[model samples]
Target: MTDSAHIASGHATRPIGGGGGKIFGFPLRGFGLVSSLLLSFASALFTFCVTTMVAIFALLIYRANGHAAVDMAISYRDFGFPASLVVLAIALPLFLTLWIRAKIMG
Candidate 1:
């Protein structure tokens, strides 16, 4: 068949290479690594902030429902640390994964 017909029928497709091309003299692989790290860091920060805010609101709710101020502090002390850690643990990795995928695919 004709060359155009062969290519159109998927008879001339090439395999993908592992080493990606560079951009502006910077390697795409390195860019992906750096971007993933930055994204993970930002995600961790955002998750921590949201977790802290939620914990504070929960404590406030408890206080408004007749608990003492000290009770709020105690509740925060009991649960806030682990909650923040858990959020960071989950969100940071997920953000990093998505960033890496986007960078590599694009």
Candidate 2:
């Protein structure tokens, strides 16, 4: 039925999203602020994992080279946590800027 007929019958047609949605729009139905956090956090987590793995590998190498004392905490304390924080800081701002740019341009 036509839109007017549907409206008169107390029913209204709505527009379906083109696909997913735009990156930015008036209704704020895109990868807005919350999504930027999620994406930045994910990137930070990835950085943490990679740095932790490298730190652990280095510790292993040190142990193999006749170092009797190796503290596993070094991997987390010296590398992973800081790296993740730095990545999170960088990524959050970067993603926010991109999101804002998309929003403004759109």
TM-score of 1: 0.48
Alpha-carbon TM-score of each model against the true structure: 0.48, 0.68
Number of the top-ranking candidate, with TM-score as the measure: 2
Write one digit per residue (lDDT tens) for candidate 2, span 15-96. Answer: 6542435445523234578888888999999999999999999999999999898889999999999999999999999778
**Candidate 2 regions with alpha-carbon error over 4 angstroms:** 1-30
Cα lDDT, model 1, residue 7: 98
lDDT of 1: 0.63
lDDT of each: 0.63, 0.83
Task: Extract clashing residue pairs from model 2.
Answer: none
- RMSD (Å) of each candidate, 1 decimal: 8.8, 6.9
- Clash counts for all predictions: 0, 0
